[model samples]
Target: MNFEVVLTCAVTGAGDTTGRSKHVPVTPEEIARDAVEAARAGASVVHLHVRDPQTGKGSRDPALFRETVDRVRQSGVDVVINLTAGMGGDWTPAKDDWAMPGPGTDMIGPDERLAHVRDCLPEICSLDCGTLNFGNDDTIYISTPPILRRMAALVREWGVKPELEVFDLGHIRFAKAMLAEGLLADPPMFQLCLGIPWGADQTVETMAAMKAQLPPGASWAGFGISRMQMPMAAAAVALGGNVRVGLEDNLFLGRGVLATNAQLVEQAREIIERMGARVLSPQEARNRLHLRGADA
Candidate 1:
């Protein structure tokens, strides 16, 4: 097991989870508040996704991102910020004509997809490595090679680290190719995304398999959705990797018990401590991962 772990709390995801949990932050103020609270509860990093306050849906609006990041920065918390660059790739084809776009389609070019990342300039922004059938529906998340290369280059140019989000082995393979092409910087960062449909399963074996494929000296974290969140975090720790947790992935602190972002971070911290691992501070994480730092 790794002696030191960087714990990340994904404050609020763009999923349909607000109705189920009142603790889910919807507005910039709420998201920022929870992110600060989570940091105080022992989260080294707070991964963020802006939501439309009126509709409680995920949004890629740069204004919303700016407000959220500003609030977090001004809150006096010293945690590292990580913004999501995984939106604007939803594609739900029309039933009648597969050739035409559908109601759920919100596909855009790489530049537009990274609009919020450019607007916020967080220390880390996610880059989903490939396309996948999202949520067992007609919806598919697209991130082709050309688009990923461009996005990686742009983030590198901006001095923002791209957290390569790999959902499966193939995604890891492609991410390796990107690294080979010199699109990613040294000591590449990775997020092993699991439990989503059509992606890798939420299990120790799966996380281990995916972790084995990462490039040497890469900094990585792994997370599983729903009930497997904490288990996967423990598994990640045991496998010599970092951990990610929050309401963005799991909603319950226990069976029939709803969780807030801070609560989730607290629980993950407890697990890490019980396993005899130290939770790294934001600066420690920055130094260990070779990040561009919080100011960047």
Candidate 2:
């Protein structure tokens, strides 16, 4: 079991959680505030995804990313910033025409997708290791092998660590291929995402299976969504991995109770501490994960 954990708080995901809970930050100011508060509450890293303030929908705007990241940096907070490079890959085909893009389709080239990552230059960014059926809907997240290779190369050039987000066993296999091809950096960082629909299930068995497949000299974390968030956090720590928790993956602190980013971080920190493990600080996490450091 891991005695020290790297706790990440995904303050605001690009999901439809804003309507369910007013605590989901939409504007840049709110996002920055929540991220800083989560850091103060014991989050070593803050994962961010910018949203369209006017519509409360996920956006790929570079300006929004810049302002939000600037606010967080200016707050004098010491936390690793992790931006979501998983956007701009949604592909929902039109009902009548399989070849035509649908209303929810927002597909773009790898460069266009990483524009915000280029602008913000976060210390780390997520790289979804494979495509998924995302939800029960007709939407499919299109992260093909070629696309992922290009993205991995781009982030490596920028000296930004790509958090290899593997959602299933196949994703893990392909990520390993990337490693073999010298596309990824040494001491790879991974996030075993669980409980998302049509991907890996949320269970200790599933996390263990995924964790066992990680490459040597790898730093990894695991998280589940909804009600399984805390359980998965505990499971990750027990499995000698780190933990992640926040409104991105879960919206409730308890039944019928909405949660803020800070509350979620506190809850996860409490769980780690109660299990006789301590959450790492930003600098500690950076060194453990072999990141470019806080200044980077």
Candidate 3:
């Protein structure tokens, strides 16, 4: 069991969740407020994803990203900022014309995907390890090995820690290969994303198995979606890994209660303390992940 754990609150995600909950931050002002609140509530880090304020859909606008991140940084909150580099990879082929991208397809080049990271220079950014059939449809999230290699190189050059996101066993294999190739920074960080549709199930067995495959001395965290969120936090801590929580992966604090990001962070902290493990502060988390914050 891990006595020291870093709790990350994924404040807002690039998902179809905005319509489900009004609590989901849509505007840059709201996103920044939730991020600061999560940090103040004992989250060591905040994983951020901007949205279209007018439509409440996932967006990759650098201007929106800039506004949200700048507000958080200027808020004087002590939290590790983790931007999502997982956008611009969705590819839904047209029904009649499979050769062309469909309406939901949001494909872009690697450099364009990393535009926010290059501009914001957050302490950590995510790199989805591989491509997989997202959801229960023909839509596939595209992240080829070649594209990953190029993005990894650029993120390294920018001096931001890449939180390698692994969805399955094969993703873990590719992550290990990237480590062998010396593309990632020393003491790499990983986030075991579980319980997404068609990805790894939200079960302790899968979390344990994925945690076992991680590189030695690597820092890792695990999170489950929807109802399994808190359970996965306890499970991850028991298995010697960190935990993540917040509106990104879950919206309910209970069976019918909608949750805010701060509430989720508070709940996660309570769980960690109850397990005889203490939640790490942002500075402590940075020390473990070898992250250099903006203040540093």
Q: Write the per-residue lDDT of candidate 1 for residues 1-296, one digit (tens) a residue.
A: 88899999999999999999999999999999999999999999999999999999999999999999999999998999999999989999999999988998999999999998887898999999999998878999999999999999999999999999999899999999999999999889999999999899999999999998999999999999999999999999999999999999999999999999999999999999999999999999888878886334
* Sliding window of 10 residues with minimal summed lDDT for model 3: 287-296
Runs in model 3 deviating more than 4 A are 294-296
Q: In model 2, what are the clashing residue pairs, if there are any? A: none
How does each model score on TM-score? 0.98, 0.98, 0.98
- Weakest ten-residue segment in model 2 by summed lDDT: 287-296
RMSD of 1: 1.3
Q: Write model 3 residue lDDT over 123-217, tens digit each, in one string.
A: 99999999988999888999999999999999999999999999999998998898899998778888999998888999999999999899899
Local accuracy of candidate 2 as per-residue lDDT tens digits, 189-229: 99999999899999999999998899988899999999999
Per-residue error (Å), model 1, residue 191: 0.4
